[model samples]
Target chain A: MQPTSANFIANARDAIADDNLQLAIARVGENFGAKRQQAVDKLPEFDALCGRAVEIKDDVLAHLDYYLEVYERAVTASGGHVHWCATVEEACETVLRLCRSVDAKTVTKGKSMIGEEMEINPYLERHGIEPIETDLGEYIIQLAGEPPSHIIAPAVHKTKEQVTDLFHEHHRKFGKTERLTEGEDLVAEARELLRGKYLAADVGITGANFLIAETGSSIIVTNEGNGDLTQMLPKMHIVLASLEKVVPTLEDAATLLRLLARSASGQEMSSYTTLSTGPRRADDPDGPGEYHVVLLDNGRSELLGGEFQDILRCIRCGACYNHCPVYTSVGGHAYGWVYGGPMGAVLTPALIGLAEARHLPSATPFCGRCEEVCPMQIPLPKMMRHWREQSFQRRLTPGRERLAVALWAWFARRPALYHLGARFAIGWLFRRARGRGHMRKVPFMRGWTLTRDLPAPEGGTFQQQWRRRKRA
Target chain B: MSNKTQGGRATILGWIRGSLDRGELSAEQRAAIDSRLANPRRNLIPARAQVDHAAQVELFLEYLGAANGTFTRVAAEADAPKALSEYLSSQNLPQRVAMAPDAWLQGLPWEKGAPLLERRAGPARPEDQVGVTGALAGIAETGTLMLVSGPDSPSTLTMLPETHVVVLRASQIIGAMEDGWDALRKREGQGKMPRTAIFITGPSRTGDIEMHMYLGAHGPRRLHVIFIDES
Candidate 1:
């Protein structure tokens, strides 16, 4: 999971040129975007619910230490262990040690963003425990040997034909020879194969949508129910969650649950919303024998009470991802990280350094759709602007860009020189058009002119027009 | 716990406190948080789920159908076994099924009604074609069924089979998810919860393959609810 955010421009160019990626991105934009609108339209209290959700998450962040302690005490009371890890390396080692304790060879995994952040699969493989992704999108991407392109929809960049190829190539080892074309057959084949994996795996790992401090339970919302089986059939269940996921109570979790599925995939409810408190009781018929939670910091604790604290309220619904124009155009791989789209643009630089991910904040068109559609009311565009300011202050921006901005500022400080320069530039550009309304090329703006013609400057500057109007 | 884990916990909590510019919480703030956790308040409930008893039942049925789940309403609890058998025969599924061993489910006269069906009460095996269990509550807001795992109610009955049959009493219908949580809190008491509590809306599904949703991805393909009118 080494970031290619430094090479975002190249990756975006490649994504834009990929036909299959374009088709998949269009489906996300058209399908998920329209469905979200319809779901929102159906709920009259959607805005009110979103406001309340924001309040809940903000409250959690303000007193995160208290809530985490309450949550840990509750888990301990329920016979579960809580492991706190400040860094990804510590988190990975904790998981490996737990697996080793159970003498586990294979572990089934539900879709977990923290797992992606920790890069636990590769870490486990290096240590001899094999991790299997049971979620369909995650399984597809795992076989393709690629990181998830989308947070919710991991293999969203792959076409069905590509999936057919992936399953055809990988399922050969399982003695399946025929190539499946229909989506149903592909799902069936994977389900059949993974059923055994779920039974055989010694441990299960899942991410928590919310950890309730009232009851010390971790909740997962999913449609396919792979997570339910993963935790139920295994000997141990380990929940990987960041500190920000903890909520105060079950009622708070319910309020957020009302928004999660609709914002994520336009469903009234996901097929399965399971809350696991601890391992099986003595009188219980069947369940995991051991329960553990790995509470990760991984830079999230540093975001508290800062200008970027609102980003921690994100529920990972992918509504902002669906609504982002740049994300829809370039797909998620171009972001070159676990998270993608508007949220990723703001969060990547914070988790990783701004120097390594300077291009992400600058990649936005600032249409404000992401902010408008966010369920938690996070000001994504404003946070991206913050990142931009920090990058500029750090001089992480390219030298040429800094020089242009500095030169513009130098003239901007003198209004008279700025007006004179503007007038000269406009007149020269108008003449260069040679009576045409547009120019195919422009100096130092080739990026803008590459895709579409630049409109020739029409009329004088705003100040000139204002003076002339006053005189008349 | 290991020293490393304890140190990590202390360090993270310290960082959070430092970032917030506070070393310790005042007496009032701690008291407020304690009360909030003790008595969790219910937030806004949508108008769609706020209804009378009869209307709530109607809304639940409407949403269940909308979510692609099928159901049958019976006047008595004894009718569930017959209805389940009919459903299995109609769908061309196997006569044998894995059923949850809840007292209410076991008390039913499966021998008198649907005698041809061979039912085993336990956790579902990999080869089970159908699973039968009783639901804790039916949510009227989104046609969801709340199933909690316990000694009698195995969690696997809902997931391993291709088809799932849920028996619910009409009296158990709730107006919203908040109501369901309240019921669970009353049953399990404060600071206690079951190992697993699953709220299932419909059959398993996925849209990852080109965004074309296909049912029965890894869980039950069909979810059938039998509402018994205990009133």
Candidate 2:
């Protein structure tokens, strides 16, 4: 999970060249985009729900300290322990200590972005605890020895045929010698394989969608019930969450829930939205015996009062990612982080520092589709602009680009000189290129013309055209 | 273990408190927050869920159907087991089914079994083919069945088995998710909830592989509801 965000340009090119990844992410472009539209259209109060969701998150953030203390007290009251971690190392070590306390050999996990951020799997392996990803997408990627590409659909970069190969290669360990072709058969094979892990594991780890402060519950939404099985069957349930996840009450959580599923995957509700308060009570028949939450700040507390605070309101719905043209084109892997798309563009620079992730913000076309679809009403484009400014202030922009921008700005400041330069340049280009009306090569735009020709300036500049049209 | 920061908790809370730049909330602010927590205001609810009781049941069935949840409405609660066994027979499933000890599921007529084999009210075991339970409430807006775990109602019985047959009374159906919360607050006291409250909308499914859905990813592949209509 080491970030290639700094090398985003090269990674994006590689992703564009990857046929399997392109084919896989195209399905997201069609599936999530259409599903979300249909779901939103069906709900008349969808906009109102989004507005309320934004309000609820803003409230939680303003009183984050108060709400988190309330959440901790409530979890303690419900017989669950809450552990706070300021750094990723602390979070990983805390989870390790909990696993070690249970003498855990085998561990099970659902799809958790925070776990990936902490690189929990490799850490667990180093400590001799085998971590098994129980969700089908996570399990597939785990078997393939790759980090999840998408937040919601982890294996969206792999095709059915590729999955068939991964299963054919991996299922031999579980004594299935045959290769599976269809998605259903592959899922069944993984289910049969992980069902055993779910029962055998001593600890289960999951991520929270919303942590209710009023009830000390960690809510997870999933179409597959892997999270339910991962948590309910294990001896200990450890929830990994960021500090921003806590909400004031179940009613607040309820208001956000109205917008969550519709925005994420367009379901009214995911198959199972399980809210785990504590472990199994003494009188309960079956559930994990212990419950613990590892709440990680990981630079988010700094974001609370800053200009980037709005990003914390994110529900991790992936709608912004789904609607992002750049993401759908290059896919999630090119972003080179656990999160991708527009949200990633704004967030990666903030978390990992602009020096390392400066390229992520510039990767956007400023289409603003991500902000339009975001349930939290995050101004994604504006945040990207902010990151761009920060990177510029740090002198992280390339020397050639900075000079080119300065040269353009010199002319741009004086409209008369700018127009004179533009008229002369157009006249010169028109004399040579009026025949074809296109330029196969252009200065300072090789990257743009690398794949196709730039349209030659056949007509007069805008002022001339406007004067001509107005006269007519 | 030694590397675990002893001050991690205090440092994080301090950072959060400091980021707001307010040392403490004023009495009025505290009272406002406390009151908001004590009495959560009902936000804008989807108009679809605000309907008559019969319409609520109809909406529940419709929404559940959209989620791929199968349903069979019986004439009365007494006829649930018979209808359930018939559905099981149709699916060519095993005759034996595990169930929660909810009074409603317990009241089903176990003696009137022809196709049905044996039923026990307990936690689901590894060999159980089907698990039956009674839902605490049914959400009409999204066709979600709410199940709260207790000594008599294990979360396992709903999640473990290959097939789940939930017995939902028509009267328990509520409109909107907020109404469902109201129902839970009424059933239990305010500020207290079951250890686990699951809202199940459909059988377990995963679209992880190229966005193609496959059911029973980790929980029940087949979810059959023996919904008893109110006479």
Candidate 3:
């Protein structure tokens, strides 16, 4: 997980030029976006629920410490274990220790984004434990040996043809040699291959969409029931989540569940929304024998009560990515992290630091669509703007950009000079492109002029035109 | 190793306290938090899930079908076993199935009713082609079946088999998830939760490959529900 956010401009340029990815992404680019609109249209109370969802998360954050302690106590009471880790390494080590205690050699994993954040697959591999991704999207990426491009849809950047080839290349050991072209056949092949792995693995790892403090239950919402299989058949189940995922009660979790699916895939509910409280009961004939939850802070705890505290309310719904014009154009790989799109932009800087992720804040055009579509009503744009301010203050931005901003501010303070400069520049540009009516190239702003033509300015500013009309 | 992890936890809590600038809460705030934890409030619910009983059942059937599931209504509890056997025969699936050991299901004559079917009350084996279980409650708002894990009800019966059959009583259907939980509390008592409470809407499905959904990925390929009337 070496960050390439510092090279976001280059990565985005490359992503734009990747026609194969563009072709694949374009097929389903507006798929989630349009479906979300339809689902929202059907639910009259979506906005009201969003408002309440925000209120609920705010209530949790206001007393996060108390909720975490209560959640821990509940987990302990239910014969489950809870571990708090401040860093990614500690979380990984804790998982490895638990795995080693069970003499685990192979581990089956559900789609846990926190596992991606800690880069657990690689860590586990280095320690001689083979990690198998059971989620179809995650499995495809694991075969390709690439990080997930999108949160919900990991192999969204790959076309079916590419997946056909990847499966053909890697699944030979499992005897799935035929290149599957259709989605059904491909999913079936992966299912058949992973079925044995699910029952054979010594441990299962999953991510929690929400952790209820009232009952010490970790809930995972999935269209595919791989998460259920992963957690059920294994002898031990480990859940990786951040501290912010804790809620006060199951009812609170249910309230948010109504919003999660509609916002995520436009479904009334995901095919499976399973809540695992602890290990199997003594009388129970099935389920994991042991249950463990590893809670990682990793800098999220520092955002409490801060200007960016609102970002903690995010429910990992990729609505913002679906609605983002930039994200749709470049796809998720350009973000160069586990999280992509608007939420990624706001969160990447906070987790990694502003020095490396400074450009992420500038990745947006301050469109309010993300906020409008967010289930928790997170103020994404305002938080991105905060990051922008911090970037400049910390001198994380380039020197020339800082100087240009400073020069603009100086002129902006003097309205008369600003207007005069505007008029002169407009006149100069207009004269230079009298017949062309557009400037294909401009001095000191080649970045804007390189691909797009700037419209030639008119004869006068709006203020001068208004004055002349008044006089007439 | 435990000491290191514990130290990390303390340091993290310290950072959280410093950032919030109110590490110590006043008496009133602590009381409020404790009260909220004790009785979590139910927030705004979508009006779509709210309706009269008959309408709620209709909505449940509609939404479940929308999730690519099928349902059948039987006249009474005695007819449920026969209907399930007919379903297995029609689908050409193996007659051997795993059933949950709930008292209600144990009372039913699954083997006698479906003479061709070989059934046992226990957790599902990988070889079992079908798993039949009873739902504790049905949420009409989303067509979700709530299955609580217990001695009588094993969690794997609903999850392990390729095909799942859920037998529900019409009277157990609730309008919303909150109401469903309320009923669960009234039945199971406060803070006495099962190991797991699974809300299954449809057969296991995934759109991971090119965002095109394919049912029966790692869980049930087909989810069939049979609701029995109050005979």
Instruction: State which candidate has the highest TM-score.
Output: 1
Give the Cα lDDT of each candidate: 0.93, 0.88, 0.88
Looking at model 1, the pairs that clash are: none
TM-score of chain A of each: 0.98, 0.98, 0.98
lDDT per residue, candidate 3, A379-444, as tens digits? 899999999999999888889999999999999999999999989988888888876879888898
TM-score of chain B, per candidate?
A: 0.97, 0.93, 0.94
iRMS of candidate 3, Å: 1.3
**Order of the predicted models by DockQ, top scorer first:** 1, 2, 3
lDDT of 1 by residue, A1-472 (tens): 9999999999999999999899899999898899888888989999999999999999999999998988999999999999999999999999999999999999999999999999999999999999999999999999999999888889988988999999999999999999999898999999999999999999999999999999999999999999999999999999999999999998899999999999999988889999999899999988999999999999998999899999999999999999999999999999988888999999999999999899999998899999999999999999999999898899999899999989999999999999999999999999999999999998988999998998998888989889999999
Best candidate according to lDDT: 1
Worst 10 residues of 1 chain B by lDDT: B1-10
Tens-place lDDT digits, model 1, residues B1-231: 578878988999999999999986888998899899999899999999998989999989888888889998999988988988999999999899999988989889888889999989999999999999998899999999999999899999999999999999999999998898888889899769999999999899999898889999999999999888875
Model 1 complex DockQ against the native = 0.89
lDDT over C-alpha atoms for residue A415 of model 2 = 96
Which parts of model 1 are misplaced by more than 4 Å? A466-472
Tell me how each candidate scores on DockQ against the true complex.
0.89, 0.78, 0.77
Number of residue pairs clashing in candidate 3, backbone atoms closer than 3 angstroms, sequence gap of 3 or more or interchain: 0
Output the TM-score of candidate 3: 0.97
Clashing residue pairs found in predicted model 3: none
